[model samples]
Target: MRIGEVLHMNGGNGDSSYANNSLLQQNVILMTKPITEEAITSLYSSLSNPKSISIADLGCSSGPNTLLAVSNLVKAVDNHRKKLRRRHSPEFQIYLNDLPTNDFNTIFQSLPKHRREIAGDGSGLCFFNGVPGSFYGRLFPTDSLHFVHSSYSLHWLSQVPKGIEENKGNICMAAYYDQFEQDFSTFLKCRSKELVKGGRMVLTMQGRPSQNPTCHLWELLALALNEIVAEGFAEEEKLNSFNVPLYTPSLAEAKLVVEKEGSFSIECLEASQIYWTGYNGSDDYEVNSGYGVARSVRAVAEPMLVSHFGEGIIDELFHKYTEMIVDSISTRPETTQFTNVIVSVIKM
Candidate 1:
């Protein structure tokens, strides 16, 4: 299956939409805000007070998180300009990019409010355009971008690995390091061409601690699928044929790709753990009950799931998935976390 054709977060403002259920990704953006701001400041300073700045948020899926990232970056750059005592902030040409099938209309609908908020802050004229395509290939003119930001996006491969047909009963792409290396390397090469010399990029994606690329949360989902298949609600062949086009690389793996690509210098690279529920405090009863986690997964995974297994099993699958998640958390709370890798790089 073509991942770009079928892959997208649930659209619109419905309860199951990615806009409402992306707290985990939102938390990731908040956690990495410091790095993002620092990169923008450093890049802006190096540019010697350029009159205009071009920024691209690759793989920018729709929702509040999308605008949140842009707002943070704009604020950071504007604040830095104020620190420099500039008379006026630079004009911003912002590009919001994702697959052709992404929910761009939803993003556009929120732009008036976004523009009003930015305008109120006196951040100067900002231009926003939707660029629909894959980041695995070039998306902009050479040396066109000054700053690039992507959060919780790069872990998705351009496509599922060619081999691994025998990777049945397991939906996670845990054992595909070679494919990840190739995809990540391609990503770096493409970005290197688009970003101007000294331009900065900050990326935050799911990662793992050790060399093992497995994600326990995805494993739990696999278990849920297997259970449903055993009950004859879905075909076992369909289960066997489906492999999630995702890879959670270790820090070492990511560092290796950047160094080998040689088009950028690593500014910062680190991994932090995030709770599966995306909230550490017990203030939210739904988050604590594991329903939030299930909903989050469904929002992202349902499109691909429906594409392969039909829509009939989605409610049942997630119902079972929520129960499984609750049981797993009760028995092994330590494993109820995802490792996130945030890397900042400068174009050489």
Candidate 2:
């Protein structure tokens, strides 16, 4: 997987708009709510047999968000253990997973603060350094983990959105989709191998309905950045350089992939139209709610805008697109959207 994709907009240390305090709260709330519903509840139930419980977060980026996941998992397991009143506390194993280049330092730094609570159960949280080498291969010892949770991640293909940068046309899209299917299938197959009997996994990723494809979101993003390229705010090379790493995988595509993987029964699969706190649901606004979504494109947009329209034209160009989105939003607030998919599967 490309390091940039793993690092996407949420690398933490404050540069990321979504990592800010207000947004992090919402993300935590959204992420934690579902863990109680499916395989996670079952995972907690297994805490009665202490040795049977193990929880992990897949694609956990460095930030308070990942730590929050760890803490919540531990608390959930503890709750289950208490109800059962078992003598042996479930041994906690936390797999701090992500691309190798992930900011482990930040993740680690945020951990010690929880040492007291994490150590309260006597059997402290075990931190594993496994970085699922590739999405297509097994990362854990067989039957090692009881629960796996991934949030706001995993729509990312194992590599850059292949051929989109080169504008490879139909051939590019077809090749990329083929690779997505193959890689996702391999990922599920490999995950199936490591989960213990009756274990479960939950994945929250961005998605689009097969019926209502939203390819225009990408077009909007591209247009949003065109101003940065036109102005000196961002680089032209960067504009043409990177892609979203994913184009909303359809629910049908997701279901087809899950169906082929064995011993994994789909529990709950849903697609919800969700709002991004940072974006004002307007296209023309460069920065919304001080979240600075436009700043994200600055890395690439700055140089491109300068090259295409000279140094000073960027602001105006960005303004033009921003206004377009704002006007668009006023016209279609309900339809102005982003989609997320939630799927939980249980092992046989």
Q: Pick the candidate with the highest lDDT.
A: 1
lDDT of each: 0.90, 0.60
lDDT of 1 by residue, 126-188 (tens): 999999999999999999999999999999998888888767799877667777889999999
| Per-model TM values vs. the true structure | 0.97, 0.76
Clashes of each: 0, 22
- The collision pairs in model 1 are none
Per-model C-alpha RMSD: 1.4, 5.2
Q: Which consecutive 10 residues in model 2 have the weakest lDDT in total?
A: 166-175
TM-score of 1: 0.97
Q: For candidate 1, which ten residues in a row score worst on lDDT?
A: 278-287
User: What C-alpha lDDT, on a 0 to 100 scale, does residue 156 get in candidate 1?
Assistant: 91
Please give the lDDT score at residue 219 for candidate 2: 59
Q: Which stretches of candidate 2 lie over 4 Å from their true place?
A: 1-12, 21-32, 46-48, 117-132, 161-165, 168-176, 215-217, 227-242, 278-328
Please name the candidate that would achieve the greatest TM-score relative to the true structure. Answer: 1
Residue 317 in model 1: lDDT = 97
